[model samples]
Target: MNKCVGTTEAASLLGISSRRLRQLLEKGRVRGAYKTGKFWIIPLFNHLPQITKGTRGPKGKWRTSRPPALAKINVNRNHIGSNIKKSPKDRKPVISVKRKGTNLYGNEVEILGPCKIVYQPDNPLDCGARLWIDLRSRYANETFSDIHFIGGSFPATR
Candidate 1:
């Protein structure tokens, strides 16, 4: 099992596409690698029978908890998910906002002409919710610099 093969040879030996082979190697699923200046080398462990596709590990895709937080970065301000404006003949401009739980990193923001409030949830509960506006242009030096509550209050927790 000490055969050293190129990426192409490794792909052919596994009867899989080169992309897939590379993925397996990167993920540590296969027992081979491309040394700094040598071909892909297969270790003795690789001689074992291949694991059939679709086999689940102990957790089986269901996570008991959420992922970790991202590296701290500057705040963003500009595209704030502010209230929508609506024009009326007998009434003032209507404003609508919402607050809800989200599945991704941050809350989901949606705004219509101006009617009702919209809410979205955040992924990691520890980081709490935040109002991020893309401040890449107007504030050339500042990447992010705005924070508002779902209820439009400072230090507001939803």
Candidate 2:
């Protein structure tokens, strides 16, 4: 007659947890395992039972069909700026600085005048570069690379 053992001893011999062995018995994965009353009787076999890998739950409907296509968006690059316009209340007030002192390069610097603050999303240096390029293009005869800021009390915009 073959020897039999409880779940605990059987799990120890099989190098698995008692709960896992109980689950295996419940799922009929273990060949010689049976439930007697509240306890389980597992036959002591020389080799461990082979448990094949399979999907955990019921098959998904997604496997049989393709996913829905996303809606396509048409965006015009030039008009993108128009959509990002902020109301006058939400805008940052322009900073006004009086030009007086010479910069480190010894070039006389001056604030041309207060201008509307230009919004540049990602890189702040790009905004400065864009302004410099604009100034260079506008006043082709004048040099603007040495323009520097001088200290002054700026009045807040009402």
Best by TM-score: 2
Every model's TM-score: 0.26, 0.31
lDDT tens string, model 1, 1-158? Answer: 35355666556544567776666566666544545654455442232213224345542221123222211222222223232232332222122122232211222232211122212355422334243322232221122222232334222223
Model 2 Cα displacement at 41 (Å)? 0.6
Q: Which parts of model 2 have CA positions greater than 4 angstroms off?
A: 47-158
| Whole-model lDDT values for every prediction | 0.34, 0.42
- Candidate 2, residues 17-100, lDDT tens digits: the string is 878767777778666777889998776443233333334865321112222211111112333354358664444323222233
User: Where is the poorest 10-residue window by lDDT in model 2?
Assistant: 66-75
* lDDT accuracy of residue 88 in candidate 1: 32
lDDT of 1: 0.34
